[model samples]
Target: MIDYTKWDEYYDGGFADEEPINNFNEEYDERSELEKLEYGGQKTNVTAKQIMQETGTTAISEKFLYRNGVVIILLDYSKGIFDKWKNGRILHCLGDRTYTTQQNTNGLSIIDRTLFNADSIDKIIVRAFWKDETKKYRLVNGLLVLSKEKPYTIEENGKYRWVFPLSLMSKYNFQMPEKYSYFLDIKSVKEAALINADKEDGVRLTTLNKLARFSSSKNDIHYKRTPQKKIKYTSVQEKIERSSKIAENALILADFKCEINNDHFTFIRKNQNVPYTEAHHLVPLAYSDLFNYSLDVEENIISLCSTCHNQIHYGKDSESLIKKLYANRKELLKEAGIVLSEQELLEMYNNS
Candidate 1:
């Protein structure tokens, strides 16, 4: 077995001297980050499971999952690699009922045992998380199967496509957890090799390299014009302006509402399709904290009618009226699919 702990030394100057990235930006923090990665680190041999757990995602040169969604690994668990005691290196047939530990002499399959050793048989479980546009994550609703015939491929824009390694794409047979939030562990394994809850984060970070990205670049990428680098340059100013526009769009996406009661309605008789309320982003582009454009996810925006918008500036009678409006329209609110909790409404009010 490879000693993964030795990886710390190896990762000192890691990512096989770092992954290649396409773009080049000297003043960008991304460049600094790339330079700092495993800046002076060493590496250790780690298991595929360990690396996968650490980074929350991994792509292997070999295919592991098929296009139709199947899984192929139970990991080294069954091989007794995760057992607590080294001597009990026995194999367990599928559906075997009992097993014996090193402390006792008799051999049982999947029954009772006093001492749990390193050679104990166990199963491996897996789950996944994804990084969405805003650098926040929503658990994946479905899963894919991984098999020898159906290995997966890492595609551009960071998508995982399922395919076979050698020839044809194969389907795997395994049930994924209903929810994406989960952990994989060695089941029925010995306690010594078992990781405790506290150190799990460490294990994950050490093995997976959670924050590292492979930085790739094309060859013959020589710079022609020698422009001296300066941080004060206004080149990113244009980029910042564009970023604001995207942020505004994100606000509109999040705060979409049909009506805020007829009282606040615009009553455009010609166009009844228009919503009575105006949806907006909470963090106005005026705020400098947001840069590189902001994601138009739910957390960044909200919807309100003209009355509420005006009342936001002069918040008093409108606050009570808004509360009553929301309370009274609880059912109508459901029609628009916006039934915010009292606490949430209050938070929006406060933030606004």
Candidate 2:
């Protein structure tokens, strides 16, 4: 069993490092590589019931094992599951068995009750894994989001299943440890998921203030460069998640002063002893899909004092403040693959 307390050790960087075993003896084994990885070399297929037993969970669901505050789901990459809904969002479907009637209420009810009740599971951590070309089950990606929508039944080919739509709050990559087991320890897995989520600024901003200081000292803010685009997910409300790191970097680059006017003084933060400034996306993340590139870059972020921040958001003269910020960042935005005419930009804010 892997010691998930030392979860940092389990991450093997990414799947790119693993090489496919093309010369492996396939004639001896009729099972595909994916099946082998999923079953951990077992001749017979492993059932979710078996996995639940191994994990020591009493959860009724065969698809997901819910314990504590986390939701662990096993995804099959070969099937190309996770249906893509309109606006580029992905939908994860519950098992094929339908459970609408009271007598049939089993696993789905447990999931619905746990997810909707606020006091129950506040954190929904998705530990996503996939079978790689190396015939190994690699922990590829993860997602952290709140469940706002209820599961509804969908029918196809005379068969019915529950479909749950999740908005992408945060998406992250995972790395496996050198020594690992196919059967995950629920306690350890939960700890590891939380740790990984924190690293990506996906779960919570617990380390945002600490990271801001470190980034300010180590990173050069003058050199304008675009960061790797984050994977976009569809949500019912069409909201986009922003990176806390990018916003922190923007604040650091601005020397923790208001961009509207540096002379506008604010109280120093007790923890960091720096002027407390908030980060704002000049081009809102909601309209990210309209552009070809990502809108969550540092150049698009602006630092502002709390008073000025509120003024820009709530004050009547927001247009003046917007104009000033746009003029200053027009060139920088162009460099970062975000090009918008001043008039076009104003219309966005005005419509909002």
Per-model tally of clashing residue pairs: 47, 6
Off by over 4 Å in 1: 1-107, 111-240, 247-352
What tens-digit string does per-residue lDDT give for candidate 1 at 225-278?
221221232664444343333333422342334233444454321233334344
Highest lDDT model number: 2
* Strongest candidate by TM-score: 2
TM-scores vs. true structure, each candidate? 0.22, 0.38
lDDT of 2 by residue, 34-109 (tens): 2211111101123445444544545545345666555545545445444332222223445435554523335645
Which runs in model 2 stand beyond 4 Å of their true positions? Answer: 1-215, 218-223, 226-228, 232-242
RMSD of each: 21.7, 20.9
Cα distance off (Å), candidate 2, residue 347? 1.1
Clashing pairs in 2: 10-176, 10-177, 11-175, 12-175, 12-176, 89-234
